[model samples]
Target: MGSNSSKISDLPKNEYLKKLSGPESISENDPFWNQLFSFSFPAPTSSSELKLLEEATISVCKSLVENNPRTGNLAALTKVFLSRTRELRLSAECQNHIFIWQTHNALFIICCLLKVFIRELSEEELQLHFTYEEKSPGSYSSDSEDLLEELLCSLVQLITDTPLLDITYEIAVEAISAMVVFLSCQLFHKEVLRQSISHKYLMQGPCLPYTSKLVKTLLYNFIRQEKPPPPGTHVFPQQSDGGGLLYGLASGVARQVGSSFSW
Candidate 1:
């Protein structure tokens, strides 16, 4: 009876230790959390581990975005991990499980994190694209290339061209960060992803095969520098031949010039 009582007495402490040691508890407040995040989202040079981290990141984003708020602000803080519409869908899914106000507040917090984490790749890593060399014969197999290509394609798809209601700047930044990391790791080499999809097939869609908003932002901001139109270059056509209208006809067409035209 005493042995059983002692074991029972130790149970609570055991549970406490488990919580303290687990991956879930490693947060910003914990000194170890940075290490965990870095390890989990390491540059792609650590291919095996990076692959695991990528899968885990996507799964967490899907779950938190879709249905899990008891997890607290972690999900909220990770909101930028998903694009805008995704957050909306996730919030709707979890509304029944959490207070609407809490969900809304959490979403704001998540967007802020995304905004901060993305505009942060170093210049050295950004330039890695130029130094890329073809893989030696046995280095990367065709299958590996295919997977990388698919991921690249997905990244491209996330970037949207919607005029006004597309993703926010914060979400765009996060997407850029993700692409920079992928580039730094050399995941999308010419021999790998670029070759997997033909130039023709890739340019067909409204968006590219893997064109994500994040990827699009990455391309514009990083891969291809979007220089402003040359100095003194006016984008709009010089006020037409009619001084801001086809002079008389432009103003008279809508009004009735002589007939008081009523639609």
Candidate 2:
């Protein structure tokens, strides 16, 4: 332990240091997950410092959702990160970390939200909301209304903050689709087909019945409105993009949702 402490202390100030700080270790009842802010990213000058700070502000969002049980925190964290009021212009080095964090964590958050949303749908609600074909075979495990709202709120913020223009629509599509796949598998349960809805809905999020439609509409409308990409423009393979730091979260949610239902 002493050697580990010394190594951590001896480590140079850099974005790498920021990564070491980790998702906060929380007990079952911490009330709020304290924001982990480590000013370890090296900034040689005042300007560099500002940039690093901005990147940190953007990059630290995942810590809020690392083990979050409520969707509200995830939504709130997204708002905080994307707030123009708090926007930080990142240094090139810091930007790399920010990008890496986003690549890994961003989509993960989405997946988690989806799980919460799907889980939130009550057994009766799921049965009612979904058609016979859409219905799974069992009961949902629990009841939590706030989950979907929290998820959609976060998703909206994510879309608004990271515009399709900056990150590109391809990345967004792949991220959402990946999230869908993940939720369908991980959160599935035998009871979900017929019994009371489970706590999974407590996390999947708000959009739900609305989200599926909203997403489809948005994807369709965007495609209809935009000019076509030039032929032979070399559309990049989305898999290489590495869904960002948030991918695990979204993937985790997807796993949950997929486990529970068909779509």
Candidate 3:
């Protein structure tokens, strides 16, 4: 228990967030959480280094999630992570290898963070408090719909544009595991998910593969919940009563969108 306590205390504190906004420029010497968002800080230069960083950062975040880190801190983490994902949308002209590497890294980060935070949410947190200032930690959730949409959009483009990127298959599967954990949360409301079927991107001929894959995943998860727990090392949040309703809405929308392209 003491070891877990040590890990929780290392989470990015309010003081560091303030310093991030101050005149002093951030350097690599700063904490990993702060450097993660710094423009000047060096991103991991190799796949192995990124894996190492993911393990370290996620180990800490797992502690924070279990111990209930402050809402403000959790909010800051989500905002910075989401901000980086926008870069993925704009890097279309880059070389294939470069684009693959960038998407791989982004998906890794997203998968790690989701797997950490998508645990069973309390009934109270489902109300969705917009303000994240100091208050009962149970009053909010950082699972933004924007994050979910960005993830789906990026995956759509990748699978449609480069079906042969075999390396991406491993990471994409990892992301699916993390994403399914959200099925029980209130975050899967129809409005936040409607674009999967409605986006012009899906109407294009090339995007058919992703649309089909998306539907299959939803249906798989729907059946998956009723079976024995999946046999994997990945930790899943305990299923809640609300998960059934949320999965119904999610599966329906995904199926509705895929029907036009389903073989």
Backbone clashes under 3 angstroms, per model: 14, 73, 0
On TM-score, the candidate that comes out on top is 3
Provide TM-scores for the models. 0.24, 0.32, 0.36
User: In candidate 2, residue 158 scores what lDDT?
Assistant: 41
TM-score of 2: 0.32
- RMSD of candidates 1 onward, in order: 21.7, 14.6, 14.2
Q: Which candidate is the best by lDDT?
A: 3
Task: For model 3, give the 10-residue run with minimal summed lDDT.
Answer: 229-238
lDDT of 3 by residue, 154-261 (tens): 555443343322233333343443344334333433245433322434454444457787666546545655322222211122234445422433433343223212
> What tens-digit string does per-residue lDDT give for candidate 2 at 25-59?
23313322122221222211223332333333333
Candidate 3 off by > 4 Å: 1-59, 66-93, 96-103, 123-171, 184-263
What's the CA error at residue 147 for candidate 3, in Å? 4.6
In model 1, the Cα lDDT at residue 218 comes to 39
lDDT of 1 by residue, 83-183 (tens): 33344434435542222223222332232222222223222322221122223321222232232233234334433431111112222323333344343
Off by over 4 Å in 1: 1-21, 24-154, 161-167, 187-263
